[model samples]
Target chain A: MATVIVHKAGLLTMVQDRGRFGYQRYGMPVSGAMDVFSLELANLLVGNDPGDACLEATISGPELEFTGSTWIAITGAVWDPHLNGQGIPMNTAVDVRPGDRLGFRGLRSGCRTYIAFAGGIAVPSVMDSQSTYLRAGIGGFQGRGLIQGDELPLGTYNALLPGNELPPGEATDLLPSDGLTLGKAKRKPRRTKIPEGLIPEYKHEQTIRVISGPEVHYFELAGLRSFLSTEYTVTTKSDRMGYRLSGEPIKHKEGMTNIISAGISLGTVQVPGDGQPIILMADRQTSGGYARIANVITADFTLLAQMRPGDEIRFTETTLDRARLFCTDRHRVIFGI
Target chain B: MKEVTLKYIPSGDSAFIIKAGDVISEEVNLVVRKLLARFEEENIPGVTDFIPSYNELMVCYDPVTVDYRQLLGIFKKCAADLGAMTLPDAGVVHVPVLYGGEEGPDLHYVAEYNGLAEEDVIRIHSSADCLVYMLGFTPGFCYLGGMDKRIATPRQETPRLKIPAGSVGIAGEQTGIYPMESPGGWQLIGLTPLRLFNPDSKPEFLFNAGDYIRFYPIDKDEFEQIAAGVADGTYQVRRTQKIDNGDGNRT
Candidate 1:
């Protein structure tokens, strides 16, 4: 039973797992880590399950102090992580002792970063996921992001491994706390780095892949051409819920923008009456009334998730089968299956 | 068996939209519900969830376990044999609404816009049984269809910053309960005492797509009583069988 204390909660840091599923029919959005690839990679670096709960820090990262010795890995959004004033590298596992402080500076690239522990965050899962749905105020860290002075419980996923327990009163600052002890022998830390080739490149401008939405025909030829040709800039109002894009207004055929509200997914590019496109994300409502012009492909969602406001995005059409192949191929790369 | 034609449209690489008809109708919705029920019973591998709207049903699936062609084959087979499948009856829910005065805020405007008296507005809104076309926009939010066209009013020119949960509103031909606090443009006419959506509650949502809803007016005292009962976990919404009136009763 380990715990970590939060000193500064950062811009927005919330515990997130793979996602909440099998409940979308009940109007529950599958809130999860926006960038699944990075979340899973961080978890894998620390020997945790792919779906293990991790801290997703947005814009800025949280400042934390470990109450017990544990392993951690940071991935995504190139946040300058530091442990006791020592700069730490991203996508690599690192060990921290009791009373060791971990902090972050301004982000270098991307929008969200994931910090995973060897043993996942021990938060009660609501509807079978630790992911936080902020709008509903349910799941994750008491149904919200971490706050200053918050103590986050960490699970023990490696009980069978050699003990890392410590002796009594060894660390002067931390008292002999229950469920934790000072270790005698300092074991050499084990670390692993993700291959450079496997790391995704985050840039200011990106071309995302998409398949024509069910209502693609609702747009005229000129609108379709413009949608493909134009580069849409992410607006300032973008959040975990959705990204509002400002570009050439996609002209719809007369009386075509409005639709009977229907189910929406993670990457649905919905064009409303205003003609601007909104790409629904993790915290999006289960359904929407706007006509979906296209859906960003599954593999490209990781690329889209890392984008920040003021970034430009262009869409390229891909076939359904090809998109499925891209997704399977990415899974194979991540799981090595 | 109803003679309905369902067109399978690919919503995305990972989902399919089974369109029952071009327009929203009870018959089309019934077909969508039947397909959803059949898909649930079939327990198709890789199928994640089914969302049934007014005239279409969206089926989300895992691309890793299922491909577009294979999923289409399964859906096509289901559509072919859908006529023989028997589905359970949709639930009928009774919602008690407190219309007009402080709770609604926009009830008078709606009445004035429709050129009808406040009482006439309430009666017209409550007399007809509404269909829960879908649970969308928010958790437990029901998109209802059955507003008397004469009483229909346009939405507020400027949207309210925060519309309280359980607020009933009208936007064009549709009527709905907010279920949760959200910024909306709909012209609100009433507020329901029941908790339509609660994460802690069993079933979590009060209304599901395809459920029949009937709104009955309640006094403020009764609203307070129901609200207290709901807070204390003793309240239960009254439900009854919904009879269908033939020959263009509600389209």
Candidate 2:
């Protein structure tokens, strides 16, 4: 069995998969990977299923020691990953041998990074998922984040290897030409990179698209205009539960911020009595009593998750049809359909 | 049949809200419950899950498999079918509560606010049958209705960092139990040893949305004994058939 020993567990590191669904009606949250695009890509690059469990690191990255040879990939943030004190590129698959040390030094951009092993992380699923919820403490590695000296068992590999597997080379070998390393040494694993054009650009400022919430009429026209026109900075209070934005107060039409508590889904922008928009995320409470202003489109959810504190974001109103189109387009990119 | 307009409003790209009415009443809640049962029977292709509340239902679906127009058409058909279906009876569950003293830190406060003795407050609370309006905010946390307005009091000025599980609280006109340890602002009036939510248990939740819950007061000694039985998994949750009043009200 393969294993990875944690040396320096950076900021917040936890195992996550697609998400835990079918339990939201019981007031249980669908906690999962914050950025689904990067998580899937990392899994695919390592020849694993798209929703395979992987490690999500915030701010910084972890230093790990591998016990057996395996394929790995790092995605999402612009972290400077290194293997055995040597620099490695992102969005590409790499091979690790026994005693190889993998770590990250500096974070250039983005808020979170995902690390995927060949067969996925072997963590017990509490509710058919390995996503760590943190608050409830019921999923992932011991239902919590990884700490120094922790050892995580890797999933057993039994699937047949692809006919044209290649051992990844330098950055120049990332293109399609002569990338295959077929019939190579057993220790030298195959590596490949996603096309450069497909890599999402992580920027400091972003304009997120949203659909009008069910209770949009509760807000005044001026308040709606201000919400769409102004740029809000992500506050420090932001977490996986919700992003508390700091900006102009979005006043209600009749000071009615409270509502009959209803189910709150991911990306629902809820405005409480304080008037600031709180965008509920993966780990948000199952339901809330605040008036929902808008919901971020599914296409931009991963982009929103990669946003760090102090990052500025502006809202743009879009129709539900357009949002659905964005979802189909994203699925095409991720699944290569 | 109630003459109610069920409006389907898009909540997001993947979810939509079906509003039964504007007010929280028995009529609206019955519609919500009936719709949930109908949807379950219909087994719509892409409707992944749903949350039924006091006056509305939030339906979440997989966009990859079903489009919004297709989902809307399915819901319309389900609504029509709901008219012909006979709604199921609401289940009745009895709750044993330890009221007043260490078991209920806010019982005296509630009594003082209502200008009555602590025992009188308990009698008023446990006398009437409570209706389960919805379950939200937390796992197995039921938003109960039918609390007598006489003992109603405002929430505490400062919320407690942690309220123990099974602690019954009163916030304004609503009465509920803390299914798990969490920060809460409701005024606690009693405690119950029953686990409202036990993931390892067969049925993770104790009460359904359209059930009836009646609380019966128990002494501290009885509470400890029941607590032990609960810990050993030998305590049987007391349940009985709710007798209907022949006027659409269940007792």
Candidate 1 lDDT over A1-337, as tens digits, reads: 5689999999899999878887776678888999988998888777777777899998888999988777789999987789998999889888777898999886778888999886678788787788999988899999998999999987644333444333232243233222532121122223367876787899989999988998899998889988899999999989998999999999999999888778887689999988889999888888988999999887888789999999999989999889988989887887772
Minimal lDDT window, size 10, model 1 chain B = B242-251
Worst window of 10 by summed lDDT in candidate 2 chain B: B242-251
Number of clashes found in candidate 1: 5
lDDT value, residue B38 of candidate 1: 78
Best model number under TM-score: 2
For all candidates, the clash counts are 5, 3
Stretches > 4 Å off in candidate 1:
A161-191, B243-251
Give the docking tier of candidate 1.
Answer: medium
| CA lDDT for candidate 1 | 0.82
What fraction of native interface contacts does model 1 preserve? 0.55
Cα error, residue A103 of model 2, in Å, equals 0.7
For residue A48, give model 1's deviation from the true position in Å: 2.3
TM accuracy, model 1: 0.91
TM-score of chain A, predicted model 2, versus the true chain A, to 2 decimals: 0.91
Candidate number 1, chain A TM-score = 0.91
